[model samples]
Target: MKPAAFDYHAPATANEAVALLADLGDEAKIIAGGQSLVPMLALRLAVFDHLVDLRRLDELGGIEARGDSVWIGAGTTHAAVGRSAEIRRDIPLLHRATPLIGHFQIRNRGTLGGAIAHADAAGEYPVAALTLDARMHTLSPRGTRDIAAADYFTGMWSTAMEPDELLTGVTFPVWRGRTGFAIEEFARRAGDFAMAGATVAVRLDADSRIEQVALGLFGLAPTPLRATTTESEVLGRPAADIDPAEVGRSATAALNAVPADIHGSAEFRRRIGAVMVARAWARAVEEASND
Candidate 1:
């Protein structure tokens, strides 16, 4: 089915786009790459009276280093992100998660900001962002605001962003010390949305003690989640003393809202989620140990 009749808008600048949204009110929606929105629109799952296109806004499309973090413009495509050497070197988790987003054709047209804003629990980028504690930047008539990744995702396909706000970019902190990152997910087929997934980041001290770690779980909850309980359990423990399987169990044990559908029941998803956490934890520790 085709999308219902709606007015198309191409704004030359972000300020203009937000202005249009502010004027259009709740009836308007922002369109970046349209990889996700197009499907929703075609299916009549989402209807917008006006679409403020950001395609012409060159300001929202670039990658740059900012102090100890990398800032990726919201309009940057997934393929562009995967091709970026800086992203691969500085933020390996994000780079690694890029190829798992549907197919090459989808990635070619999918934008980083769109993925995060769409806020799918199974999306690789959302889980990666949560794992890295990335910061989201937004613009509105009121001015610019920064939202932490932990607080950014509020519910299913919902965010803290106001209707008039435009997501401008994301800032991912660069880990400087001996660090390792890995993401693991279980999907029925290649390029399918994961049933459950985990993204792990670990920084180890010289003596093989865990200095810092993050376990971000996706496809197991309504929103991308951080396994804080499990992280706290192994925070200062020696790498050899911690068991990945135990950590996985602890991570999923605290989850209360794992989704259940035809693909899998909540209990089944938790089981898969635990395994993903365990696998990701093992790989991440191995890399950190080698470093």
Candidate 2:
């Protein structure tokens, strides 16, 4: 199937792209790498009267270190991100999650901003951003603003961004000290979206106590979710004393609105989610202990 007929505008600057979006209103959609949007368009899942392309906006593509955090432009391709040494060293969670996103071909054309803005429940970037407390920066006719990852995702394939707001970049905070990160998921096949997945980040004290820990779950809810209940339950506890299996169960226990589809039933997803959380938690803790 082919996409519906639409007018295309490739803007040379960020300001110009947003201006086009504002002028075109809801009828216009922003196209970056178009890895996700193109498929939706081809299937007629999404239709737009106009598309404001940002491919020519050089300002929206780059990776920079900003003191304690790393800022990645929305237009930066996933392949670029996976190849970035700074990201690999500073934000290992995101670095590790990159390869799990579809395949090399998808990553070659998929932009960071497109993945986060698309806000798919099963997307690796969204779960990694949520786990790392990344901040999303946006530009609009009204001005600029930043949204916390926790508050950014609103529902399945939905976000808090307004119609005219263009996501310019994202800043992921770097975890210092004895920190470790791991991500685990269950997919039916290679390069397929996971049935259930978990990303875990942990920081341990010198004495092997859990100083801070975050568990982000994907493919088990309407939106990517943080296992705050399980996090609070295990925080400050001795690393050796906590049971990863129990933490996994607690992570998925209170989850509501777990999706049920041909992939799997909600209960089955919860079971798979628990196993993922456990595996991720164990690996993260082991890495942190050795750090």
Candidate 3:
């Protein structure tokens, strides 16, 4: 099916893009890389009257290490992010999770900002941001504002963004000492939209005990969920004392009701999610201690 006709505006600057969005209001959609949005348009599921293309905006694409954080521009392609030296050096979790997004072709076309803007609960970037406590910068013709990742996602396919807002970039804080991060997922097949996935971030103390743990999950709820329940139980515990199986069991405590579809039952998804969480946690912890 052909998409409904729409006006397209390719803007060269962030300010111009924001202005286009403000003028188009609710009728406008932002296109970067066209990974997710293009599909929606082809299926006739989305009916945007205008599209403000950000691909030409030089200001929105790049990856660099700032003073305290690695700043990833909104327009950076997932493939670029997957191979970024900065991302691999400062945050392996982001690098590990990027390949899980889709096939090479899709990753080549998918923009980081597009994923966040789409706000898919099962998407990779959302969980990464949530677990990292990254900061998101959004701009509108009115002005610019920064929002914490913890507060940015309101629901599945929903965000704190106003109608005219454009997400410009994300800032993930650099960790101190030796840090270990791991990502694991359970899907019907490799590269499939993960039926369930989990990301674990572990920071060790001088003694190498678990100092801070952030567990984030996708396809476990309405939004990329931060698993504080599992985190609270893991902190300050020796790696030997915590069973990998026990951490997996804690997944059930963090997630109760997951969406049930043909891919799997809600109950089954919760079980798989738990197992993945445990594996990722143990893997991260092991890497942290060996260093």
Candidate 4:
């Protein structure tokens, strides 16, 4: 279906994009990759009087390594992140998860910022950002500001972003210690939205004991959920002696707030979430020990 009639503006600069959004106000939507927004537009799930296109904005489409963090442009595509040498070497978890998003075609068209702004519970970017304690840079008519990843998410598809704000970049800190990353999910087919999924990143010391662990879940909550309970349990312990299934069960209990749908029941999600969490955590352990 054709999208509802809307004016389109392709701005060449970030300032121009923000100005357009400020001028259009709530009637405007900023589109980068257009993978998610286009579908919403076509279905009339969203109607805007104007679209502020940011694809041409040079300031929002590159990756850089700064002092201690890896900065990813808001307009950077998933394929770019998946193929980046820096990501593969520094943040391998994100590198592995990027290819699992949608499919090859969608990855080429989906923007990192778009996915974060869309805030789909099942999307990989949100969890990855949160797990890494990433920071997002946002601009609006008011001015530019940085927001911590944990505080940015408000609800399903909702964020701290103002109507006129455009996300410009995301930056995540690097860890020097041994780290492991893992993701597990259940889907009817490759690239389909998951029935349930989990991603975990763990840091370990030379002794093989956990230094830190961040656990996140998708398709089992309104927003991508950080499994604090599970993280608390695994930290300071080596993966070898830890019971993944037990830790997973604790994490699974945190999904009590997840609403049920035709895809699965609350109980089923709890079960699957436990399984995924266990598997992902185990992989994280292996990577920490071997790598």
Candidate 5:
């Protein structure tokens, strides 16, 4: 199906893009990469009077390491992030998860900001962002602000972004301690969106005891969720002693609702989520031990 007729505007700057959004309001949608948005538009799942393209915005097209953090422009492609030495060095979780996003063609055209803005519950970027505790920067006619990863995603395919705001970039703080990361996901095929997934990052003390751990669960709830309960159980425990199955149960216990669709039942998704969490935790533990 073809998308409804809409006006298109290519903004050379973020200011111009936000200004266009301010004028068009809810009628305008900002598009970058066009991986997620274009498909939705084509399916008529989303209807907009105008599309404000951010591809030409120079201010939103670079990757840089700033002090203790890595700043990735919203317009940067997934493929670029996956291959970036700086990203792999500063934020290995993101680097490791980028390849799981989609096939090569999709990653080459998918933007970090677009994926986060789309906020698909099954998106790998959201899981990585949550596990890394990333922050999102945004601009609007009124002003600019930073949104914490925990607060950024409000629902499935929904975010805190206002109609007139534009996502400018994402900032991820470099892990300070000895850290290990792993992302485990299950899909019908290599490039398919994960049916369930877990993104895990663990920081260990010199003694090999877990100091800090984060587990982000995807495709099992309305929004990406941090397995805080599971982290609590794993913290301070020796990597070898941490039980992945128990951690999985703890994480799922905190979730009040499990999503069910034509793809799977509520119970099935919950079980899959548990398995993903277990696999991710085990791999993360192994990696941390080696580090």
Candidate 6:
């Protein structure tokens, strides 16, 4: 099947995009990377009367650092972000997670903003955004606003963004000293959507104890979920005292009702998610120790 017939509009500026969206309302869909949307459109899973292309917007295509935070333009490609020296230096977690997103070809065209806007539960960008506590910036004909990652995702394939809103960019606060980061994911094959994945960022004090931790988990829920239960359990604890296997299990123990599908059972996914969280936690500890 092919996508429903739609009028296409290429907007050269952010404001123009916002105006198009406002005028078209819910009938308009923004196309950036077109990685996810194109497939959906091909399958007739999604339909729109208008396609608002943001590729020509030069304003939404760069990486910049402002003080303790880094702002990544919505139009920036995964490949561009992966190769950025500044992003690698300022935000190691994102740099490390980028390679896991599909393959080189997909990365070359996939935009970070597109991924976040899609809000796929198993998406790499959503996991990074959640773990990093990134802030999403949006523009509408009415005004502009910033939505915290915590509040941005409401459910699978759903977000806080309104129909007329345009996601301009995202800002992530840089983690400095004594921080270690790791990403662990399980997929049927390379470049396939992960069955389950976890990203861990840990900070240690001078005593080598865990000072802070953020765990973002995917593929086990409707939305990318932060393992707050696990964080509370492990925070300020000595790394040596925490067992990776046990921590992994306990981290997702509360989610006994995880979704079951053709790829896996609820139990199987929970088990895989647990192990990922454990591995990520262990690797993060090692990273922090060596830092």
Better of 3 and 5 by lDDT: 5
The lDDT values for all models are 0.95, 0.95, 0.88, 0.87, 0.89, 0.91
Clashing pairs in 4: none
**Model 6, stretches more than 4 Å misplaced?**
none
- Which of 5 and 6 is the better model by lDDT? 6
List model 2 lDDT by residue over 46-143, tens digit each.
Answer: 99999998889989899999999999999999999999999999999999999999999999999999999999999999999999999999999899
How do the residues 169-222 of candidate 3 rate in per-residue lDDT, one tens digit apiece?
Answer: 999998877578998888777777788888999888887778888988998888
> Which residue runs does candidate 4 get wrong by more than 4 Å?
none
Task: Please give, for residues 1-291, the per-residue lDDT of candidate 4 as tens digits.
Answer: 889898989998888888888788888888888999998889988999988888788788888989788999999999999989998888777887897899999999899999999998888888889888899999988889999988998888999988888899999887667888898888768998777889989988889999988998888887888888778877888668998998789888856676688777888888998999999988988988887
TM-scores, all candidates, are: 0.99, 0.99, 0.97, 0.97, 0.97, 0.98
Q: What TM-score, to 2 decimals, does candidate 3 have?
A: 0.97
Instruction: Score residue 251 of candidate 5 by CA lDDT.
Output: 85
Model 5: lDDT to the true structure? 0.89
Residue pairs in steric clash, candidate 6? none
Per-residue alpha-carbon lDDT of candidate 5 for residues 237-287, written as tens digits (9 for 90 to 100): 888787899888888876767877788988888889888998988888888
Please report how far candidate 4 places residue 248 from its true position, in Å: 0.8
Question: Of the candidates shown, which would achieve the greatest lDDT relative to the real structure?
Answer: 2
Ranking 1 against 4 by lDDT, winner: 1
lDDT for predicted candidate 2 compared with the true structure: 0.95
Pairing residues by index, what is the TM-score of model 5?
A: 0.97
Q: Which residue segments of model 2 deviate by more than 4 Å?
A: none
Candidate 4, run of 10 with poorest lDDT: 254-263
Residue-wise C-alpha lDDT for candidate 1, range 54-164, written one tens digit per residue: 989899999999999999999999999999999999999999999999999999989999999999999999999999999999999999999999999999999999999
- Native-to-model Cα distance after best TM-score fit, residue 110 in candidate 5, in Å: 0.9
